[model samples]
Target: MLKKSDMIAMALGVVLGAAATVPAFAAGGGGDPPPPPTCAKGQVYSAKKNACVKAERGALPDEEMTQYAYALAKQDRFQEALNMLDLLENPNTPKALNYRGFATRKLGHTEEGISYYLKSVALDPNYAQVREYLGEAYVIQGKLDLANSQLATIKTICGTGCEEYEDLARAIEDSKL
Candidate 1:
């Protein structure tokens, strides 16, 4: 059985490794992946801090909404995540584009997904998360050379010890096995 923490890491899209083949149903009907974070009694979720801060009125800032969309995507709720992305004020922001790419790729729109990921990376060359995901996409497409390039880019951005570097490198290695 996959540990609950391992599943959480997968949900966060960090590094599921080859163990993800264990099957979701293998979880033995584990409950949903935590409610949409209610943020204590008075705080609100912050993507910057990834925790909660004093609640601000009006619509949620784009960063928080993007994080929420990612959570939705992690649960395999791709369409709902895309819907949330569409409603964002700056839908074209790099982070938003990355989530859109993630949802699109998971939905099997490979070429389109790569386009979105490319757009996001173009916007910010140092975006290691986007690079890791983009590398995964390349691996799925059987583009080993391209995937290696992304791993190198991640290494440059985050060094060899960063989670992004390690996860993407594992993905590239796993693709060969």
Candidate 2:
């Protein structure tokens, strides 16, 4: 009685339901709520170990390093963030590329940052945060149309009320003023 399409839909539903059970951190929604960014330049706060750890390559998980790098970029420590990002074993991940773009852009390399953001977006089109950063970069380059395109994508991914959408929206607004 069931068509092949119906069976495939049911299987997909089951897989998605299982994926929904994963913890937000494990699923890359922010990663264990990183500790305060008080670690030294060569160290990163490890949530699992509950303390700072040397940021040597392979010393910590790639995801943790990527998250810390993003945090460092937020603090305007662009070079330090890039150092940490370089330590990632798999640097091509969406989060890693997004952070790299963020740090690069902050360091005044807009084109390089846009390249990284494009790679991140290619890997994960639904990643709203990357879209937001990409939109901001477009704004910086005075490309309002490209920024608006990213804004529309973010609106579809997380709606206009989400932080990514709000941040990009604010950046676009501020650009026009």
Candidate 3:
């Protein structure tokens, strides 16, 4: 008889294989292709390739709620960004929460923004941009230790010369002022 650990490993392998094959068959039209994801405005249906195009133009949203929030944030209209964030189908999504947190922070709701930023980080710890913003928020609140920790993590994840790394570095430095 197989040992317990061996059985467990075999089960895990089967599950993983099934999971992998499901995606492959799904992509091959085993079912109808999923409906295209929508743009933030709800005015346009986005093809897969178009979902992240706006980021290339220095517009940060590029996908669903994020794009809407970015547009409002660009106008320095943080309340509107919050409103758009509220309208997202999946408000708990890290991207949505991150944008909302950023917008709220811009509007001077620092505590509320920090809460949302924390939520975003909890949802996706690997999201370097969210970590950067969380560090900025901590700095704004005079939480230097937390800010430094987050900044160090951002540096490690985003790479030394990346725009996010530079931005976080600047924010950290400015916070000391």
Models ranked on lDDT:
2, 1, 3
Task: Give the TM-score of each candidate.
Answer: 0.68, 0.79, 0.63
RMSD of 3: 12.4
Q: Which numbered prediction scores highest in TM-score against the true structure?
A: 2
lDDT head-to-head 1 vs 2, winner: 2
Each model's C-alpha lDDT? 0.79, 0.89, 0.71
Off by over 4 Å in 3: 1-62
lDDT of 1 by residue, 1-177 (tens): 999998898777744644574565344222323335545433445655767665433247877777777777877878767876776778888889999999999999988989999999989989998898999999999998999999998888879977778888999899899
| Candidate 2 C-alpha lDDT tens digits along 64-131 | 78878888887888999999999989999998999999999999999999999999999999999999
Predicted model with the maximum lDDT: 2
Work out candidate 1's RMSD over C-alphas. Answer: 12.5
Prediction 2 global C-alpha lDDT: 0.89
The TM-score, computed over Cα atoms with residue i paired to residue i, of candidate 1 is: 0.68
Better of 1 and 2 by TM-score: 2
lDDT of 3 by residue, 73-137 (tens): 75686776676666555678887888888998998898999999899989998788788888888
Q: What is the full ranking by TM-score, best candidate first? A: 2, 1, 3
